[model samples]
Target: MTRARALDLARILFVLLTLGCAWLGFRGRGDEIADALADTSALGLAAALLVTLLGLALTAILWRRILARLGSPVPERAASAIFFVGQLGKYVPGSVWSFAAQAQLGRRHDVPARRSVTASGLFLLVHTATGAVVGTAAVVTGVLDAGGPRWLWALGLVAGAVVLALPVVRRDVGPAMVLMAGVWLAYGVGVLALLGPARAGLDDLPAIIAAFALSHVAGVLLVIAPAGLGAREGVLIALLEPVVGLDAAIATALLARVVHAAADFAIAGLAALRARRTGVRPSPGLRPADRRTDL
Candidate 1:
């Protein structure tokens, strides 16, 4: 079989495996999620989704900055559509899918494949590094204090990626890491907001944030799980249960997965519409080729 076909098969099998694991886990303890949902606060969920959206928007801005730095900048609308729509690929198995999608989508907006791919690579690198650093700090402060040394390997990986991509994104390292930290912070806040600060308590905030960041890194590094589906939830629950108890931890994990997925599609949908209806208008001196820019 061709490499493409093999990859497709692997994705399908891994997806099935993830689904099977989820089904079994939920089957035994489905009542926890249901009970949690019964007690769930609408205001909290709404607040969570709002913060999650804000984080996602920040991510798009980061991508746009990366693109511009690479000399293949698209308009804001074009950037949104390209970035969000490309992000849909993360739902598929494989960490590289989103990057590949971004690179392809960019070509429609006069962004060359090479620059777009490079920018996406750098974006992931910067994002991973920030998540690692933040996660490590959080862990040191409260969560898994003993495991902090082992987790330094994650920091090492980040350092290696930054070294490799530094030449291209040297100017963006500081800002990109800061922006990525903001994204994680927003998501951490969203998780707390969803669970209700009363449940997690202000004292638990740092641990919650640490759990959020580390669980995400675990999910991404696993790679076999689509969008970190089963892996993220498992790691999240594991990290949170100690602080929040089993029921609240499970609820937070499940709700976060659903809310974050909804947020992703929402951003993708709106950006797709915006790009389709109103991207950058062509100027009078434009060539016919430039006028044909597809959303």
Candidate 2:
């Protein structure tokens, strides 16, 4: 079979797996999930969705900055569509899917394949570094205190600082960091909005934010898990347990997963619509002609 056909099959299987996971996640807590849905305020859901969109917009801006720095700048609209739509590939069982998607989508807008790949790589690096820094600080500052060896957290902080310094050393600083900060902050806000529907208190806001950062970082690093399926929720619940108790933490993680998945699909759908309207055809896989630009 051709690579395109294989990719199509893989995508179908990934979708099935994602749905299966979601179904199992909600199965044991059917009544609780239903109650939460019934009690959810329309306004709260809208607010969460809006915050999610804002976070994605910030992420798009960050990607644009990265591409421009790599000397393969595309228009903002193209960048937004490429980033958001490409994000859908994260649901697949490989970390490289999103990068591959972005590189192919970028080529439609005249970006060289190597530069596109570099931009995606750099974005992930910066994003992961920032999450590490924030997560470590939160833990060290007594926010989520997971009670591991203090030296390990300290080492993580040092490593994060070094990773973060690479971009600054390369003179690709300032706006990228600011935009990434906004992206994470918006994510924190969206999580808080999820908590609102559950009537969870915001007294431990600092811990919650730290948990968000740490769980996300953990998820990203665990590339074997599709979209960090079980890993993210496990880490999130573990971090939140001290502050919210086991049951509430579990509920929060489950609900947050559903909300986050909805947000991702919503943005991806919008981006797909935009790409279609602009007459841009998404490449299913790399062709011989497309592989000329080496990474």
Candidate 3:
């Protein structure tokens, strides 16, 4: 079979697997999930969704910056379309899927294959490193009590950032870092919104944010797990257990997963629709080199 056909098949299977995981995740907690959802304030949920969108938008902006730095400047609308639509590939079983998708979609807009891949790689590396920095800071500052070896984690984050700095210019790093900080902060606020109905106190906000960041980092690192499936929730629950009881933590984690998926799909769909309405089409007769074999 052709590489494109294989990728299509893999995506389909991954979608099915994601659905299966979601079904299994909430199977036994139906009543709790319902209760949690029913109790959640509509305004708060709306705010969470809005914040999620903002975070995603920031990510797209960051990606655009990375692409431009790599000398592949596309229009903002086209960049959004490429970023959001390609982001759907994260649901696939491997981390490379999103990068591959972005490269393919980016080519339609005259972004070279190598540059697209470089931008995607740098985007991910920055995100991961920032997450570690944020997470480790929280842990070392006595925000989250995940016990021992916090210093080691902090050291590791610094080391990783240093390595990533080789490809990123000092000028581009500031804005990208600031944008990513906003992204994670927005996501943390969304998590706070999710936990509000559970009466999780304001005092635990730092821990919650830390857990959210750390769990996300963990999810990204565990590439074999589709969309960081169980890894994120597990890490979240563990980290949050001290602040909120186990049950509340579990409910919050589950709710987060649902909201995240919703946010991703909503943005992708809206971006695609917008691109269609605006008549944004790929450059004629342009084809990207096949990078699927690398995956």
- State the lDDT of candidate 2 residue by residue for 47-114, as single tens digits: 77788788887887888777765556566666887787677777767788788777776867777777
Expressed as tens digits, the lDDT of each residue in 193-251 for candidate 1 is 87786787667767787788878877878887778877888888888888878788888
Q: List the residue pairs that clash in candidate 3.
A: none
Q: Provide the clash count, candidate 1.
A: 0
TM-score, prediction 1? 0.79
lDDT of 3 by residue, 1-295 (tens): 9986876586556445545654654578778778878867887778788898999999999988777656566777888988887777777677787788788778778777877888888788888878877777788777887767967867866765785476454546778778988998888888889878556766777788788888998899899876788899999999888888887788778888778888887887788678768888654322334222110
Model 1 residue 113 CA deviation in Å: 1.4
Off by over 4 Å in 1: 1-33, 143-165, 279-295
lDDT of each: 0.73, 0.73, 0.77
For every candidate in turn, the CA RMSD to the true structure comes to 7.0, 5.2, 5.2
The TM-score that candidate 3 achieves is: 0.84
Against the true structure, candidate 1 has what lDDT?
0.73
lDDT for 185 in candidate 2 is 80
Give TM per candidate. 0.79, 0.82, 0.84
Model 3 stretches astray by more than 4 angstroms:
1-32, 167-169, 281-295
Q: Kindly report which residue stretches of model 2 are placed more than 4 angstroms away from their true locations once superposed.
A: 1-32, 167-170, 197-203, 278-295
